[model samples]
Target: MNRIDVHHHVIPPFYRDALAGAGITAAGGRALPDWTAEAALEMMDLLRTATAIMSVSTPGTSFLNDTSAAVELAQRLNDFTAELRAVHGDRFGYFATLPMPDATAAAREAARVLDNGTADGVVLLANSNSEYLGTGGQGELWRALDERGAVAFVHPAELPAPEVEGVPPFAADFLLDTTRAAYLLVRNGIVRQYPDIKFILSHAGGFVPYASHRMAIAIAADTGRSILDILDDFRSFYFDTALSSSLAALPSLLAFAEPSHILFGSDWPFAPVVANQYFANGLDTGVDAANLAAINHTNAQVLFPRLAGAPITTSAERPVVRLRHTTQRAVARALFKLVQPGTN
Candidate 1:
């Protein structure tokens, strides 16, 4: 369909080069994909995506570990992204990344970026160097975003844990990372206090949907609040269908998430073309017409009014281009099972 991708990644030349210079080659256990404006357009055309909201993926300039360096890099990356949006306002938009872990610097940059209209929204990693968002330290940043009614895209990053043998962090740890951030935000009353800020959780909220009741029950017991109240907080955040539009995951996401809260996300570049296509195919096949239309087009237009929209397109109306990699699909299913942290 005419999709608005809310979870696409952009690796600008300077950002990519900076990562290389730091001897950091991978993000969340996946090799960084080669990206260019031309390449991104080509993929969007293939996927029938009309507008892709870009964000810097994991291991952002936060790896610099120096406040001054992180601040400088955040500005550079945000400025470059803003330039792209300025030039390609129709085809592209961006979520500005903050120099996080340093909440003060992050809050300052957030104000500057959002005030100048340099970004459509801001992208925050679930945790920056083990200091998760939504905690007391980040109250200032949350307040800044809340005051502006800002859209915050909570993307996953590598956690502070050692790697598991034969398991990719993107598949498993990233899920827990997003879940932890979501739990913290809800548990600590950040969502309630900062009600104006809309937080979009990546990877269908990373097991939060399926395990939400467990979280609610635990928190209710701990806080002596009603389970429904905790559940309400858990459901307050938005979810993107990046790497999660499947029979297994989408069902829970659709069931648990408010219908209007689910947004389309390709996780492109990081999620290779084949993988993106696989999930797109699942979304096409699994959802009904109206829901598909909402997820792909209408919901995004509501979230980002400035982004232009086109007529809804569906695989049913067009020639079906079937996914070619059956073997890869099988492998993906197996990996998905391995990475479901809440299951065990």
Candidate 2:
């Protein structure tokens, strides 16, 4: 199957060098991997990934607090990716990086990148400098993206805590981090308000699908909305299978997400070649041919029509069908009331 990998990553040379210069050798408790355009292309060819939507991995520009530096770095990275897309148009596309936590700077960069066609969309870390996207002045950034009806790819970053004794952050903490961001966004009602902005959650939305009913229950209780209403909002976000195409994770993702919302992803470089191969194999064997075709490429084409160069057939274009967790409302309401004492 021809795959359009939405969750693929790019680590630019300058960014890598900057990290090394700052005496930083790792990100999210893992050592950074070496990356090159030639290497990425070779791997894509082997893996049958037709196109990769690239973005810089975590510890993004927010690793530095200076707004000026952040702006410069964001520009430089977008420019580099744009050049790559220009040279390798068929094989690569990119999500523009923005320096967040400084909402003003982020807004400016978002406008500049999207307006100039330097990106297919933008990639945002779940939290930047302990400031989650749903908090503080991030509305400016949201407004900017919403204005253009932009696609915002959400990736996870390390949480604001030291690593636990033996656990690697990427394996577990990253999941929690992404979950936290999703929770805050739902709680803040950002998803409903910004209907135009398509938020693509990486790593199968980081425990979101499995825990969505629970999340919806909490939101319902807090906002005085019905469980069903909250659940609908929770289901609206998009999910990408990066390192999460295994049997353990795929079922929940497939059940909770809209079929049209499940996009293919290969979190390359960071997720080593073997790991990528493993997940690709899992997806190949695990899903039915029809669903697999959508996850592989068609779903992504729906989100990014620019990637669809050839004529799209009707069979390949599946209408988005909303799938609900039948037991969620009854179970969640009981749990919510049980946890909150006399709130009901």
Candidate 3:
């Protein structure tokens, strides 16, 4: 399969050095992996990935306390990735990095890159300095992205909470972190208000596919909106299969997400080549021919139409058969009990 990997990551030399300078050597509880354009292409070839849309992973520019310095670093990283894409147009696309928790600066950077065609989209940390996405004061950035109808890849950062003694943030907290951001986006009306900005949730949307209804019910209860409407908004976000193609996860994801909203993802160096292969194999064998083709590349072609060589089958073009709300509610109740055993 010539897969288009949407969750690929890139680590520029300057960014790595800055982390070291700040005494921050790891992200999401793992050491930074070595990355080069050549090495990335080599891995892509090994994984049978035709193209990889790259982004900087967690802790993005958030490590820099000085907003000005963070803004400068973001510009440099974006320029570096943009040049890489310029050189390897056939193999690579990139999401521009931005200085966050600084919405004004982020909005400016987003416009600069998107207007110039230098970025496929932008990658946002699930939170920056404990300020989660969809929080107040981010309207400037959201408006800029919405105006462009941009693709925003929401990758998880390290959780704001203290870590458990033996658990790595990436192992579990990352999922919760992504889930929190997704929940806020829907609950705070960011999804509804900025409908044009396509949001791609990484790590198969963390716990989203499994807990969506539970979250939807909460949102409905709090806001007095219909649970069905909230659930529909949850489904509107896109999801990527990166380290999340296990038999258990893939099935729930496939059942919960619209067929066209699921895209292929390989976390590359961060996930190790062997792990990437493991998940890819799972996906390949899990689905039938047509569905496999769509998950691997066809579905992504709709989001990035320039990549499509033939006729495209868009989400709108595909038949959408939603699960009945009553059934989803029943399953949600069961899952809620499973995850929250003591709850009423």
Candidate 4:
């Protein structure tokens, strides 16, 4: 029953203020939810997530022209999450955000955060400019992560292009970004060079499950090596059971990945239908309960050994505190009002 979530989102006060003059339809416009520390803890209870490792959800300062501002906000967000870990006394952990689109600034933040032992890992967007994750010299960021065999949770973000009228930001654009980033790593050899870093792919490895056949053929045509042969790079990589844990995806994932390489992800308020979606579709009964604990918390201990461990147990060793919203956290309800982006 030791459950932990490796993928969750938080809106820092900095980015919230930056969106003021920006119209709802700016480049790959993002919607704001009434996200607050209190509401997040409550959602944790409903989702049965004992501890959530939060990260910089999309718009990780990739759009901002001011690189310094991006760096400042990134540090502040890290500080805030670390404070949450401090306040909640180990119910949460976080991935550090870096100001992408600027290699030097990003390198500085990653080095500082990880070296200080503040972050569990880093959450990198698929692209910061027109360049994808492995392109634009972004490999340096991964190299820094590699030095420590750290976790790299690759979450999808909207492409910085004008919207294609019918396609909502949440549609194909996000999926495409995830695919492009993963493909870029393979092509650019970043995944090959930095084999030490553990990369966690979001949204059930994006569309890679369905598209791998075509990609495999393309690679076979060029390199004479099967794409699945190359997928071994991802052997060290991890997959989070986010919204894609539903029927359409779980089967493919089961067929593709060993369960130990799989982890839990809620995608939280944005993908609220996740848990029920899996429930309605049914989960793979073969999944290991102990491994489920690993997906939830144990493996994270492997990732961040310094992070707080198992919750306090009762006389029967049962987790008496489970996921209830403590009275102290409920006081945060004053600010956690629901808003747009349609509830998750």
Q: TM-scores of all models?
A: 0.91, 0.89, 0.89, 0.82
Clash numbers, per candidate: 1, 0, 0, 2
Q: 1 or 4, which is superior by TM-score? A: 1
* Tens-digit per-residue lDDT, 95-198, candidate 2: 99998878888888899988998689999999888989787678888899999999999999989888897787888999999999988888888988888999
Q: State the lDDT of candidate 3 residue by residue for 66-154, as single tens digits.
A: 99999999999999999988887758889999999899999999999999987989999999999999889999999999999999999
| Candidate 1: tens digits of C-alpha lDDT, residues 1-344 | 67899999999888888999999888988778799987887788788887889999988767987999999999999999899888876678899889998888988999999999768889999988888876778888988999998999999998878989888899799999999999989888999999999999999999899999999988888889889988999888999999999879999998899999999999988887767877888888888999999998788888787764444433223443445556556756655554454553
lDDT of each: 0.86, 0.84, 0.88, 0.68
Off by over 4 Å in 2: 310-344
> Comparing candidate 1 with candidate 3, which one achieves the higher TM-score?
1
Worst 10 residues of 4 by lDDT: 314-323
Q: How many backbone clashes does candidate 2 have?
A: 0
Per-residue lDDT, model 3, residue 104, is 98
Superposition TM-score, candidate 2 onto the true structure:
0.89
Highest lDDT model number: 3
Looking at candidate 2, what is the lDDT of residue 98?
91
Q: What's the ranking of the predictions by TM-score, best on top?
A: 1, 3, 2, 4
**Ten residues in a row with the worst lDDT in model 3?**
313-322
Clashing pairs in 2: none
TM-score, structure 3 vs. true: 0.89
Best by TM-score: 1
